[model samples]
Target: MASESPACNICESIISQTIQTDDRKEIQIARHTVNEHFDRLQRELLKELQIIENDKRKEISKILAPVERKEKEIDGLQISLAIIKQHASDLQTFLVSKQIEHELIDTDNLIQSIQNNSELSGVIVSLQTIGMMKSLGNISRFGQTSQSDMSLVRQKIKQAQAKVAVVTKGSLDHQHGTIKTEEGL
Candidate 1:
């Protein structure tokens, strides 16, 4: 058999010390027990490390959950803003069209108003004369002196006489019974 590995100094000393009072192999057996205890402690430390790692993972997931939700919410909000912008643009276009339509209507109304007020073709004037000749006696004759409404009739005749004597061509000649075919200007 191969020569047995020489014992380490500390093991040799433990062997000698224990051998003095106990069995010769008690030191080696006690050393084996210590190694077993160390292995148990190492296993316990590894288990504790695994527990710590699991707790850290749980905590990290908890911290990340809200972050993920907020990120998704931010993305959703951005999309909403983009859609709203399109709607806003459409609304702007609608308002502009309405404004243009209003302007067109206003322009048409203004043109109609301008056309109606031209300073021509205005000749007749009718006056209300309800109680003009109430005290007069009734007279049904045309050009009568005692007519019931003689005052109103006289005023309207005077106004018509003034409007017709405007001398658009010339004044009327004072020829007695002059016919138009026989007259020369």
Candidate 2:
């Protein structure tokens, strides 16, 4: 079929040129015609896509409104829940602080009782004197051991606190860090 198509004649000619295609202008015209058709097809496809995209945008807007409203509702609920949680944490801290206050009152009473007792004070002094004498005897030999023991304890505390720091700070931001345990220990 392609071979059967007739060639067009152009104006200029080479010595050996045929009547069908004699010059560069004719070749350029043919190429331009094919390219124009291809360009037109591409433009039609793009226009079709644009129409489809506009329809999709309208459809999507209709569908998305309810989803957007539901998302806002969910966000509102989350914010409310966060506020409630914050209040609960605040109340918990208040309760703990109140409990600590009660325990501190008990501790103060006990400490006051001890301080007011003359007999207890004498016993404390004698115990301290005996402890001092014993420690003085071991001080030269056990000084390094005692220092190392203190260092080890501090190191353990530092490591533990490092691990606890994040949790502690976050909790404190949400609540409080006042002492709440019983005072005896």
Candidate 3:
């Protein structure tokens, strides 16, 4: 019985050592499993963050694209406005020069008539000429334009362009015009 007791104790000690080794192995396995799961979770999170960043980049580009287009349109409008101003200035200068030439020709004709006619006939002709000159003067002044008038015209053009720009901006940003087509093809 004494020998049997010692054998039993030795068997218990061996069993306990075996259990302890198995427990250590299980702990190591558990630790490895947790580290693997954490690594997978971190990779998935990084992938999700990359996708979110890509979506935000696309959204930001969408928002700024229209602004870039509008800036280009404004540049085109400015170029057109400059051309219009130059043309208006040239036309005004040409018309004023032609008016001065016409006045000089009329004065020359009146002087020739006075020199050819006698005193009494010249007086009658002079009275008739003065009446015609007054009507011509009225006709000439009817459509006369000055620098201030040109400026007013340019101002009106600017106002009209501004209104057009607003309308254009609306159309550029969103579809507005209705489609009109034949009912049947």
TM-score of each: 0.32, 0.34, 0.35
| Each prediction's whole-model lDDT (CA) | 0.55, 0.54, 0.57
Off by over 4 Å in 3: 1-13, 73-185
- In model 3, the worst 10-residue window by lDDT is 119-128
- Using TM-score as the yardstick, the better of models 1 and 2 is 2
In model 2, state the lDDT of residue 134: 86
Candidate 2 wrongly placed segments (more than 4 Å): 1-24, 85-185
The predicted structure with the larger lDDT, 2 or 3, is: 3
lDDT of 1 at 93: 58
What is the descending TM-score order?
3, 2, 1
Best by TM-score: 3
As a TM-score, model 2 comes out at 0.34
TM-score of 1: 0.32
Model 2 RMSD in Å is 53.9
Query: What are the per-model numbers of colliding residue pairs?
Result: 0, 0, 0
Q: Clashes in model 2: which pairs? A: none
